[model samples]
Target: MGVPVASGASPLDAHELLRKGEVSRALVLFEKMHDPRRPDPAVLAGLVESRLALGEAHRVAPLMPHLADAALHAPSKDHHTGLAHWALAGLAELEGDHDRAAGHFRSAGEAGPDDPDLLPWRAGLALALTRQGRSPEAVRLAHEHLTRARASGSAYARALALRTLAAVDGASSRRDLLTQALEELEGIQATRLRAQVLTDLAGVLVLLHEDRGPGVIRLLREAELIAVRSRLRPLLDRVRRLLTRLDQPAGSTAPPGLEGLTPSELRVVELAASGLTNREIAGRLVVTVKAVEWHLSNVYRKLGISGRKELPT
Candidate 1:
């Protein structure tokens, strides 16, 4: 009988363990491996994913060149190369380089022609386009992605697509379409989606409410909460500014105490008072878009204001 030799774990095993959050075990096993070139694309991808989860984008950047080279050299194109592009796009998006992000996302989509995972990137590209003032193109791309996402019945993808649609609709002042988009988001139970919907809804309501009274305040407050919970700093900032504008008295010289605002609330309020948008506020505060909204909602409720026009003077 042949004796069985005890051996260390495999790279695939390490990758799986890492996916399950067993980082230490994965590292130990991975370190024991001798051939750097031996790890499969899946293993490499997993390592990249692990690094991303650990918030190490910078570390992941160096691996991309190798990943790209590996993909180009492989006899048959695999999904790994496409995934690398996706990762690059995500990193760019996080860094607020939308143009670069869009380019990478497009490349990823071409690499993985039928990948469902790429839907989010497509939707993101559409959003970026809209933000860049390419409304017609954004709407077209959003509709295309929305059709695919709806057909796939992917809750996450659908929610993202709906948000993109809402953005497009909001830009065009198509309230009915935006309303439908909000309903779609609500159906998905996506709190982040709801935050975005509320923010857009509040903005629309503000425009519709000529008096800018308690009703506007109520909408803004609701939007604020949703944004904060979702860490949507941009929406939160918008809500805050809307609130401050509402609070300003016709002839008042000084801004009011903006009573009931928590520290975060005060921060948002101050930013809003300075006329910053939600996106800008989020960047300045280094908070998620949702967090900004949450604070804004709290601020509105505490002040007993109904509209942006009713904020303390």
Candidate 2:
């Protein structure tokens, strides 16, 4: 049998490296393990982290069944169950199942309130709630997560929590809180975290543009650069749409490609931009879900936007 690492260099060390952003080192350690059956839950979780950091979500999914089964059958109940739920929640978020995502996040939070990862899951849940028009509850829950993250001293958690706070605060017209979120994000150095926060700040700026015009444009441009460099496509799309809307001149003609969209497609785009699901859009448009999906596909092709997140207002 293969022996475990001695003293300070244990599987937990590998997990620590993963948490500290040393992804290559963590992956190397995980690859050297002798037996899959002997793998520490922390090491398995680190593997998940490494894959997620690389944006390999499909790869991460295969491991979820194994991890979930282990967590469910383990002798003692622990944070692993929560981690599994959070992983599934992340997949749901990527698939745009906001309701399911929120449920999973809530389960994760209740199972592992002290887990650093749970803070981000809670923040994500709060953002979903905000998008679903539960602004007051969203604001309250976001602040609660922010408080926990700050107390935990996890920079990643703090950054995500701040982004959620910015979103909720923007929705509730709390400009001062959004300003504070922007200032907090300015000091974070991680590229992915910085890119996400800059995107959130740009969004808040867009909401506040009535009182601050060029200022919002400047922030959006900065966010655009960061997002492009970081290869964060979702945030990049948001920045692009925000800049496009901001740059439209008063009484300007519709752009060339946008002019080709049918009125129904345009309405679908508007609702999609507001975060409505195809089913909801279908109900609003008095059409079948498949019809709404068809319109959205055509709209996406005409607009050259790949994701619903990129739909124009």
**Top TM-score model:** 2
How much is the lDDT of residue 15 in candidate 2?
61
Lowest-sum lDDT 10-residue window in model 1: 248-257
TM-score of 2: 0.58
**lDDT by residue (tens digit), candidate 2, 201-242:** 666556656534777667666666654433334556676777
Q: Tell me which residue pairs clash in candidate 2.
A: none
The Cα local distance difference test for each model comes to 0.58, 0.62
Model 1 scores a C-alpha lDDT of 0.58
Any runs in candidate 1 off by more than 4 Å, and if so which?
Answer: 1-87, 90-96, 113-118, 131-133, 169-173, 207-215, 229-235, 248-313
Model 1, 194-288: lDDT tens digits are 55566566666666774377765666676666544333455566667777778832221112454345656766765554345567568756898
The segments of candidate 2 whose C-alpha lies over 4 angstroms from its true place after superposition are: 1-58, 75-77, 113-119, 131-136, 153-158, 169-171, 186-188, 211-214, 247-313
lDDT of residue 292 for candidate 1: 78
TM-score of each: 0.50, 0.58
